[model samples]
Target: MGTRQTAIRRGTNLPRMGDFNESVVLDAIRRVPGGLSRVELAESTGLSAQTVSNICRRLLDHGLALETGKKSFGSGKPRTLLRVNAEARFAVGVHLDPAVITYVVLDLLGNVVAHLRVPTPPVADPEQTLSGLSESIRQLIEESGVPADRLLGLGIAAPGPVDVAAGLVVDPPELEGWGRVPLRDYLAEETGLPVVMDKDVIAAAIAERWAGAAAHSGNFLFFYLGTGSGMGLVVEDTVLRGVSGNAGEVGGLGAACTTRGMVDEAIHLGVLSHDFTPIGPRDAERSLAELCRLAAEGNATAGDIIDRQAVRVGRGVCAAATLVDAELIVFGGPIWPHVADRFLRIVPALVEKSPFVKSLHPTRVTSTEVGDDVGAVGAACLVLDRTLSAQPQSLLLA
Candidate 1:
C-alpha cells in the first residue's frame, strides 16, 4: 500500500497561525514510510526548524505522531524519526449504491479495519432506508471496537447528481423516490459526527489515488462499473469536480454500460430467456452474472454480447483518456469483479492502439487494487483526506 505525496505547499512561519504549517509538516511526515526527523521535516516542508519542532511536539502530545526510532546522518547525534500514529484516529465511510449499501471504517492510513454490505432496502420509504443505514453504521462501528472519541467523522458516497453545497442527494436516476434528500445532514445528525458527501465515482477515484493502484498516478481516469457506470477524472493530482460537483457523468456512455441496459439487451437478443428480464436493480445484477457465466461457459451469443460491450467501454475510455491526457486508467466498482477478466483482455490493447495515447504518452490500463469495495473504502478516505491531509486551500483566510 503505497501513498503518493499530495501537491506541495510551503509552510509559513507567521506567529499565531501554525495550524496550516502544522498540517504541512504532518502531511510531509505521513507520505514517507520510514518516518522523518524534525530536520528532515523542516527541509522538505520549507518550514523553519523551530516551527517544525513546535509542530512535532504538538503532534506527539496529541498522540497523532510517534517517535519510531533514531536515524543518524554522518557523525552527528542520532535524530529521532517521527511516524504517523495510524490508529490514533479513524473515519467511517458509507457508499449507497442502487442495489447495495456498503459500510467501512478506515484508520488514518486509509486501511479498511472493518466493513459490511447489505442489499439496498427495497422499501420506497426514504426515511426507513435512512434509518436502516444509520443503524448499520452504528453496528459496524461498535463491532469494530473503535473508540467514539477518536472517530474523526463520516463520509457518504452516493449516486449523483448531488447538491454538494446544500448536502443533498438530488434526484439520481437509479435511486427512486429520493428527490433532494438531505442525506448528509441526516446522517450527521444521527451519528453525531461531521459528514461529507460526494458522487460514488469521484470517491472511488480518490480511494485509488490514496491507497490503491493509482497511488503513483497524478493523471488518471477511474471508470466505475456498478449498477450504473461512470468515470472519475484526476488531472495533475487533483480530483476534478466541476462547478456543480458533477463532472463524471458520461452521457450515453454511462447508459450503454449499465447492468440493466446490458441485461435488457441480452433478453431482447434472445440470448437470455424473457424470464431473465430484470424487475429491479438486484435482478439486473443477477441476470448480468448469468450472462457472464454463460460467456465463460462458451456460449457464443452470450460471449458476443459481452465482447461487444467491452468494445463500447474501451472506446469510451480511450476517448476520455485522450481528452484528459491521462497516463493511467483504472477500473473498479461493486460490479467490476464479475467482468474484470473479460474487460482486461480487451481494454488494454485498445488503449495501446489509440493513436493519441500512443503518440503523446504511454497509457496503462488495469483494475483497482482496492478490490470491489473501493467505493466504500473511498467514502472512508473522504473523511480521512479532509481531517488529516494538508490542503493548500486551508491557508486561505475566510
Candidate 2:
C-alpha cells in the first residue's frame, strides 16, 4: 500500500483540555482587565459557586490566576477577585528570515520579556545553523531569569512553500539547501522542548489577532514585506492555511499587474524591491535601509522605486481585498520599520483608486504597531494561542 496522505489540514493544534471547566473559567477571568470576582466569574461562566471556588483554587495554585483586592457590588461582603497571572509562564518565539534570525520571549499576557536579532546563517549548513540558533534560545531563557520549567514551548515561523505536514522547509525559493529539512523536529530535539512551526506570514496573522493591529478585526489581510513579499488572510476569525500550507502567496500578483513581460515568481524578492532598492545585496547592512536613506535625502530614483513598488503592492492588496472582502490590511515585516509610514500613506489611496475596490468602502491600510518584532512576536503567540486561548472546539467537547 502507498503511504497515507495527510498533507491536507488547517494547521491548527487540537490540544485536549485536561479540565474544560477550569479552562472556561480561566478564559472568562482573562478577558477582564481588572479581574473578576468569583461571583462574577460564576455568573458569567454559568458555573456553580462551589465549582467556581474549586476551579479558582486550582488556577491560583498553578500560578495561572492571581487573587487581587476584594470587590463588593452591593451591601454584600467583599469578594476576592481573580486575574490572569501575566508573569506566571513564558514562551519563546523565533522568526527565521534569510536576512536575519529574530527571537522574542513573551510573557503570559503577551508582553515582551526579552528580544534579540542576529545575523542569519545560510541554510546551506542547516545543522550548524540550527545548533547556533538553539544556543541563542538557551541564552534568552537563562538571561531572562525565567525558570526553564515554566516555559511553555518554542514556536517558530519560517518562510514558506513549506511542507506543513512534515514540519519541513521544502525548497522555499529565497533560502538555499532547505529542501525537506524537518525544522520542527530538529529544533524540538535540539532544545529538548516542544516545538510548533508554521509559515512566517501565518504566524504574523496569529500575532495580529492576539494583541496587534488586527486585535478585534474579524477579517483582514496581513501584507508581509520582508526579504520577499506575501500575504496572510484571516477570514471569520481563523487563519486560512490552504491545502499545501501556502494560502496567501501573492508575490506573483505584483508582477502580473505590470507589463514588463517579467515573470513574478513566489520565491523571488522582486515584488519587495526594485533595481534601485535591491534587498540584501550580500554586502549592504540591510536591504532597503540605504535606499530609504537616499529617498529621504531627496533622491528621485530611490523615491521613484519605492513609489512604483507601493503602487503595485497597493494594486495587489486591492485585488485581495476585493476577493476576500477584507475589512483591513496590515502591512508588516522586518523591512516595514524603515518604510512603514510611506506604505501606509501611499497604499490606501492607491487601493481606493481601483474602480472595483472604490465601489466597496475603502479598505483600512496601516503599519504593524508591533513593528520589526512582529514576526518573532507572532511566532511566540502561536504557542500561547494553541495552548491557552479558548477555542470553540472546547465548547463542543465540553
TM-score of every candidate relative to the true structure: 0.92, 0.81
Compute the lDDT for candidate 1: 0.87
| Total backbone collisions, model 2 | 0
Q: Which stretches of candidate 1 lie over 4 Å from their true place?
A: 1-17, 72-79, 358-360
Q: Which tens-of-lDDT digit does each residue in 1-398 have in candidate 1?
A: 13344344467887755777877787777667689889888777788998999899999999999999998899999999999898999999999998999999998778889999999987666998899989999999999999999999999999999999999999887777889999999999998989999999999999997778887687999999998888999997778999999988877675657888788888888889998988778888899999999989998988877877888999999999998999899999977887889899999998898775756678999999998889999999888777776665777776
What residue runs in model 2 are displaced by over 4 Å at the alpha carbon?
1-32, 37-57, 70-81, 255-287, 351-363, 393-398
Residue 125 lDDT in candidate 1? 67
Which residue window of length 10 is worst by lDDT in model 2? Answer: 1-10
